[model samples]
Target: MTSITATSAAATASTAGKVASPYNNLNETDFLKLLTTQLANQDPTNPVDNTQMLAQLAQFSTLSAQNQTNTNLTTISDQISKLTGVPIKVG
Candidate 1:
């Protein structure tokens, strides 16, 4: 468990390119680091709410999916443009 200050410091460092991160983006490593810190520091007397934790996990999953989808779409769009000689935008 990390103190809030430690977590904040880590995030700040990450944003400053201290971590092997991807273009100042929040990636899986950051998520897992935060999650691990949270689980380590949670009070046993009042543990993290299961529902909230689940929701957070779900959100992370969805975000990963969306990022991958967007990357794939971009690649497809590029391929299509190359094949058709016309650029097409994809989301």
Candidate 2:
């Protein structure tokens, strides 16, 4: 039983480390699946409020959009810096 539990845990961790998307790893489909699972498993007596859920979803959408925007800005900045012979430091 102990060995089985260890193997299961290791398998779970290994699967989680696998990249599902080559670009934008945390995409909409993954986000929606997680949200659905949370909703399905929530406590019935004190369930998550509709307003809070919508707000959370909106926040996720905003974060994803911001990440895309940041990526685009970084790419453009890098291109401009290259043209201007300026070194851009990214951390």
Query: What lDDT score belongs to each candidate, Candidate 1 first?
Result: 0.89, 0.85
Q: Candidate 2: deviation at residue 1, Å?
A: 33
TM-score of 2: 0.56
Compose the digit string of candidate 1's lDDT tens values, residues 1-91.
8557888998887787555746458788888898999999999999999999899999999989998999999999999999999999985
Error of 2 at 75 (Å): 0.3
Q: Candidate 1 has what TM-score? A: 0.71
* Model 1, residue 58: C-alpha shift (Å): 0.3
Q: Write model 2 residue lDDT over 1-91, tens digit each, in one string.
A: 3456888998888997685755557678888898899989999999989998899889998998998988988898899899999977644
Cα shift from native, residue 42, model 2 (Å): 3.6
Clashing pairs in 2: none
Q: Give the least accurate 10-residue stretch of model 1, judged by summed lDDT.
A: 17-26
lDDT of 2 at 85: 91
RMSD of 1: 8.2
